[model samples]
Target: MRVGDVFLKVDADQARIEVEAMALAPVPTPKVLWRKPPVLAIAAVPGTALGRLGEPSTASPAAWAAAGAAIRKLHDAPLPPWPGRGLDELAADLDGECEWLVTNGVLPADLVTRNRQVAEAALRPWTPVFTHGTDVDLDVIRAWSSLRSLLGVRWLVEHGFDPTAPGCEVDVLRSRM
Candidate 1:
């Protein structure tokens, strides 16, 4: 991976060495203003495995329901140093960001009302789950939502609903569901 011409060459010799990459640059001299902070590129994977069901087979309804149950079980499976402090701090940080969003005219002024609700929601703490890897297991909610949305997409394409248009298969699928 190359970031601004700094090529990252990974090989077996260096596999056990470096764990992270930091950009080499001169630090800014108190230059921050009303601009939003940068978000690092998370080449992101789908939060959950539920979306990997590439196709819906010609199986009974019970089969699909069973798959959903299995996915829930997979997510519930436990794994270690549950970072309590980090989670709380992160939630508070997100609340502050929402405030900044409002302050910087990020969106319509009237939307501040909704943003406040979201801010409150963001400030709420969550129970952390144990899983592999050291980094925070963030985005628990968003992951589930993404998975559920994928399932909906799967259903739509299964019987054939032109998600972009009209189709009899889609109508039949919706009616039966």
Candidate 2:
């Protein structure tokens, strides 16, 4: 929620993480105005959002490249004190979500199966970094994208987003298949 120039973020654990991450991140992040338990007030940063999930990005190629470079810098930063999700945990969650998607007919069985197979490549050992959960491998990246789309479909629908929109998650999965 926005209050004047400050945005108030609610959520205790996430707020804490955001505070720490902002401090550690090499890229520019919103300046923390203040913090009070579940409430974190941050000064608004400059620039508009890149785009929505299902929409075409209006950002220039140079902007995208700059974003990529910033991500690279973040990944190169020292790992945070907290541990990220383990491979076994991530794999289990992916499998469960895929099963749910297929069994509930949210996505095609074949598409889910194929995405599951592709996601297997990402279920390997890797060095930890200060990232918001992304990997370097192209296949692994695609796999995560598929999994995120699958997992997000229900929430998106609940929030009145059309997952079946032309450039949306469903289209992304179909294109991969």
Candidate 3:
């Protein structure tokens, strides 16, 4: 693949992690061309990102379906070797942050506790899949959601994707389980 002229300066360790994550993704990702201590060269994907957060998507419905298909493929692939972080650990981290917020009076204790209770849906056991991390994952999900919302569940049903079913693009590793 042709490496794009664009160069990104990032921490060496983070660049390594990004490269590794891209390699493990079942969906199309930029190809890593080379690495220097603080700059990583990678080929550009054929298309721009499906959309950015809070922006209207100009991509066609076909593009959305293609993305959903790709995400399904990625989610269905074998789990990555890294423990990453368990749901319990993630929940604990949230709890710790909430405690800090409450103690600092940034948020009321009742608000923090309520949010924690609501977050229980995310605290179940799950098999970890390859991810670039929370921010990257959130962006992907935001793009996906924008596309899906534009087309709506009826479109998914008509297109043979199970909007309500487990393991569909909407499920995306069951983060809400």
How close is every model to the real structure, measured as TM-score?
0.33, 0.64, 0.45
Better of 1 and 2 by TM-score: 2
What is the per-residue lDDT of model 2 for residues 1-177, given as tens digits with 9 covering 90 to 100? 445577765432342337886788878888888887656789987877676655788998888888888888887888767776677877787777788788878888998887777767667886666763444578767876776666556655555656787656787777678
Candidate 3 wrongly placed segments (more than 4 Å) = 1-19, 30-59, 107-114, 129-177
Error of 2 at 74 (Å): 0.9
User: lDDT of each structure?
Assistant: 0.34, 0.71, 0.50
Considering only N, C-alpha and C atoms within 3 Å, which residue pairs clash in candidate 3? none
- lDDT score, candidate 3, position 77: 73
| 49-162: candidate 3 lDDT, tens digit per residue | 676433588989999988777767776677655555455655565566556656766445664454455455445554356532323444444433322222233334454545
Could you give me the TM-score of model 2 versus the true structure?
Answer: 0.64
C-alpha root-mean-square deviation, candidate 2: 5.9
**Whole-model alpha-carbon lDDT for candidate 3:** 0.50
| Candidate topping lDDT | 2
Worst 10 residues of 1 by lDDT: 21-30
Q: Candidate 2: what lDDT?
A: 0.71
Once superposed on the true structure, which residue ranges of model 2 sit more than 4 Å away at CA? 1-23, 30-65, 132-136, 158-160
Clashes of each: 0, 0, 0
